[model samples]
Target chain A: MTSFFIYKAILVVVVFGIMLMAAMYSTYLERKVAAFIQDRVGPNRAGPFGILQPLADGIKMFMKEEIIPEVANKTLFIVGPCIAMLTAIMAGVVIPWGGELVINGVPYVLQIIDFDFGLLYVFGVVSLGVYGIMIGGWASNNKFSLFGAIRASAQMISYEIAMGLSIIALIMMTGTLSLREIVEFQAGGTGSTWNFWNVVYQPLGFLLFLVCAFAECNRTPFDLPESETELVGGYHTEYSSMKLGFYLFAEYINMFISSAVISTLYFGGTNFPFMNDLGLSQNAITILGTLAFFIKIGFFVFFYMWIRWTLPRFRYDQLMYLGWRVLIPLAIANVAITGLVMILTDRI
Target chain B: MKSLTGRAKVLDNPKMTFKERIYLPAIIGGITITLRHLFKRKATIRYPEEKRTFSPVWRGMHVLKRDDNGAERCTACGLCAVACPAEAITMTAAERKPGEEKLYREEKYAATYEINMLRCIFCGLCEEACPKEAIFLTDRLVSTDYARDGFIYGKDKLVEPVDKRVDVSKRQTPNVLEFKKIKHYRHNR
Candidate 1:
């Protein structure tokens, strides 16, 4: 038990470090992607290929002035970005990074926590993600920030419904709320029964979930809250120094979490097909699974950046319309169709 | 009426069809175009380490000329100052002493010359006005400076270095060279 506790502690630290590093580098990747899309060379001076740009940026963010509004609610203003970063880091706990690792004849799960209701736990924490934005925006005493806060809250709420519906369909098919079991259920046989990868079973659900994920992360097209033309810097408009850094970091971490969730729920998480045939050792397979998982996460991150540069922001009306009218209805129809198909096939 | 060039068409803002209204296909098309551009050659020159070739006749920073024998070409005739639309050029003429024949080609030479770059329009009118082939615009831009007074380029900034040559021959076209030759011939006559 003591050894297991030690393992868990190490895993927690590792996951936290990975989350922070990934968030930091996401900013660099965002700039590079934007530059590429526009046919310009981005930030290549700091280090080789500008890989150290994020480190430079972090240092710069740290060195900046931390200004709080004189008339603002100082306590909430201070707590806002702290809450944002905290919530952003908290969502990765239940995500299974790999299958298992056996060290000295003791098997250890690669995930930090594997609660039975892992899906609900992630959703619960993510829903609280809005409080950070709201508090920051409201406390700023700026009308633009307040408007952004309101929009953000409304957007998150509207999209959460469709997102929940989409996940509900997946839950019905998998019959478990645990993310680990969902991955296990999707792990198909070597011969070609590679039957899982929930995307095959729930293509429409995946699409709806993906669109909802974009909104949930407050990414482009759905990024009306932070629309520079409208709200300046939006929720973090008055935030500066590391406080502002925390808000931006929280956003990237949120993107990372959403990508992880999507890949786990639909793309088979860390389960690589035909691994048994390769005859790799158990520990080797675990390592390979983690690598495969990162590759999937990387692709999704790229997709986020790709679509961001590709698409323009939607009008506020269009955003609400899509969330309520388009995504919700599609998610419902997907759930119905999935239920009907499962019933007809007697797989329920 | 039809366009003389067969390219022009009537402009119309037609209603979007169902497929177009969805916008997915158009978005995908835009993404494809942008993706294609991702691999295309970038148009920027990156300034310091790399430079784009300037056009042969490109007018940039001013350069007071020197003949191949390294004698100053300006005769302090003030034609360039007179032709300057901005009136940015100012010069003080001094008679060339007998011993200074190797230094100054003409009997009269500009003792103190200055061109306020902030006021100059960079239209190459001064180059066109110079009868002595003394002034030409070279393919070097005036660098940025903090003080407004820094923009006032004196003879030290404008003149060609003695040991190292500054080439502005490309800017003197055949017509201009012939015109200079004729002007010199008329001056001698």
Candidate 2:
């Protein structure tokens, strides 16, 4: 029992380390991406291609000053980014990185805890993500920040419905909410023949899921809360130094989580084709599969950075309109169509 | 920017109707557009190793000419210094002695010619005003650096080597009198 606990602890630590590194690098990458799209040289002096820029940025943030608004909620002001960071990291816990690892003859799945309701658990965790922004904006004691918070909350809630509904269609098709089962199903076939992959069979679901995923994560076009010209700094208007860093770091963490979920649902999670047929050992296959999954995930993450740099943000009313009128209806119709098709095909 | 709330809400309103509110059709349409651009030949040029071609007439950085015999062309006539609207050009006059005839073309020559590049508007008036045809804006890329002081162009910094012109005739000297006469001829006619 103790050893099981220890194993879980180790998994948590490793995932935490990945999230931390990815978050730090993501910020540096965002700047580099922006520069690249505009045909300008970004930070290259700090390190090779400005690799050490994250460290420099961290140091700068830490050394700088912190302030509290006189009329603002002091506890919540500090709590805002903390909650944002906490909730962001918390979303990663249920996500499985590798399939399984047997250390000293003790076999275990390389996840912190594989909850039965894994899909819902992710949705639940992400839903709470809004609280961080809401609290931060409210605590800011600025009317602009409050307005941003309201818009953000409304956007998130509306997108969450579409996101949740899209997953229902996937869940119905798969017949299980468990992420591990989804991976196991995909493992048996060769690359393109893998019917287990969600992107192939449920392409409309994947499309709706991808769009909702962007909105849920508060990415560009949907990034109205912190719109520089409009809300100033948005929820973190009054935040500075490490506090601000926490908020930015949380955003990357949210991105990593969302990317992982997308991979798990539509791209077959950590599963690759006919690994046992390839004659690789179980451990080797598991490691290979894990690596393959991350490669796909990394591409999606890069895609986000690329898209973020290339696109312009949306207006507030436009954003809300897109979320409610557009995404929700399509997601519902998609769910209905998939359900009807599955019943007719007897794949259900 | 908050568009002026009262007026902008009405004038610039892309009002969402029944179908417009449903974002998927619009998003799909938009994604189709972006995907085309993504696959299309990108207009972006990876700088440093690969550079975009500049025009032959592109007046980038300035250079002070030396004669075919390697003589300083300026007489420190202060015509360029006086005509510069930006007051970027500065020079001090020095007299050439009998022994240093090879060094300078005229009796009075520029002792120190410096341009505060930060102040230079690059209006080409200095090129217009030079009687000796010494200063010319050529197509040259400048090295970018951090400091504000690095931007200032000294006499040494602005000077380019009198190399064999690949495009222009190698034997031709930049004749200030000839150029001035051409300008005078144009003006007179």
Candidate 3:
């Protein structure tokens, strides 16, 4: 039990470190991707190919003068970013990094927790993410901040419904709420056993979930909350120094977590095709699987940036229309179709 | 109204079709376009490390010229000062002593010549007005400075060094060279 506790503690630290590092680098990658799409070179001066740009940006953020509005609620202003960073990190707890690792005849799980309601835990944490923006925006005592916060809350709420409904279809197919079991269900490669990824079973659900994920992350085309053109920095308008940094960092971390969840839920988390046919050792397979999982997450993160640069932000009315009318109905139809197909095939 | 250039596009407000409304195909097309650009050659020159080459006839910073014996060619005739539309040029004339013949090509020389670079429009009027081919605009850019005084370029900043010469051969067109050979021009004679 003591060893198990030690293992869990170490895994927690490692995972937390990876999440922070991934978020840090994502900012650099975002600029690079944007520059490339526009036929420009970006930030190659800081370090070779601007690899150290994130560190410089972090230092600059920290060195900036801290400011609090005279009319602002100081306590909530401080708690806002704290909550954002906290909830953003919290969602990563349920993500299954890879399969189990056996060290010295003792098997250790790569996940922080394998709770039966792992999917629900992620959903719950993500829903709570809005409170951070809301509290911060409201406390600022600025109209723009309030507007951003309201939009964020409404967007998250609207998308969460469709996001949840889309997942219901996947959950029905897998018959498991635990992410680990969901991954395990799709274990074998495309061979004799033929356990395909969940995407093959829930293509429309995956698409709906993807759209919802973009909205939930407040990414572009769905990024009306912090629309710089309209809101003037939006929820973090009143924030300065590391406080503002925390808000931006939280967004990137949320992006990283969203990408992870998308990969785990639909793209077969750590499962790779022809994985079993390789006849690799359990430890080797686990390490390679972990690597494979990270690569998939990386691709999704890049995809997010690609879409961000390609599409313009949706109008507030357009956003609501798409979320409530288009996505919700599509997600419901997907769930119904999935149920009917499962019943006919006797998958239930 | 009829289009002047005959290239005007007609405006329309047709409702979106099912395919357009879905937006998946358009999104994919945009993604493909950006992907192609990602692999295309970057348009950036990465300035400081790389600079674009200027045209040979590009008029930039002014340089005071010298004769073959390295004597100052200007006789302080003041034609350039008169020709400068921006009133950027100023000079003081001084009589060249007998022993100073090696330094000054003419009996009279510009003792204190100055050009206010901030006021000069780089119109190459000074080059056009210099009868003795004493001043020409070179292909070197005037660097930025912090002080207003720094832009008042004196002889120390403008004059070509004895060891090295400013080449203005490109600016001397065939017509100017042919006119110089006419021998009737007092400076040419």
Worst 10 residues of 2 chain A by lDDT: A187-196
Lowest lDDT sum, 10 consecutive residues, model 2 chain B, at: B164-173
What's each prediction's clash count? 0, 6, 0
Quick one: best TM-score, which candidate? 3
TM-score of each: 0.95, 0.77, 0.96
Stretches of candidate 2 exceeding 4 Å from the true structure = A35-43, A185-187, A190-195, A334-348, B1-177, B180-189
For candidate 3, write residues A1-348 as lDDT tens digits: 898789999999999999999999999999999999999988899989999999999999999999999999999999999999999999999999988788998888899999999999999999999999999999999999999999999999999999999999998888889999999888866666668888888889999999999999999999988999999988999999999999999999999999999999988898888888898988888989999999999999999999999999999999999999999999999999999998899988
Over all chains combined, what TM-score does candidate 1 have? 0.95
A1-348 per-residue lDDT for model 2 (tens digits): 898788778888999999999999888877876665555556776878789999999999999898888999999998888889988999887777877766677677877878878878888888898999999999989988898788789989988888888788888887887777766656556565445588887898898888788887788878888877887888888888898899889999899889998888888788776765688766787798789888888878877877676568988777777778877887899889988999899886
Rank by TM-score, descending? 3, 1, 2
Pick out the ten consecutive residues of candidate 1 chain A with the lowest summed lDDT. Answer: A187-196
Q: Which candidate leads in lDDT? A: 3
Local distance difference test values of all predictions, in order? 0.91, 0.79, 0.93
TM-score of candidate 2 relative to the true fold: 0.77
Write model 3 residue lDDT over B1-189, tens digit each, in one string: 999999999999999999998999999999999999888899999889999888978999999998999999989999899989999999999999999989999999999999999999999888877789899999989999999999999999899999988888888889767876777866557
- Measured against the true chain A, the candidates' chain A TM-scores are 0.98, 0.96, 0.99
Clashes, model 2: 6
Residue B70, model 3: lDDT of 94
Off by over 4 Å in 3: A190-192, B1-11, B179-189
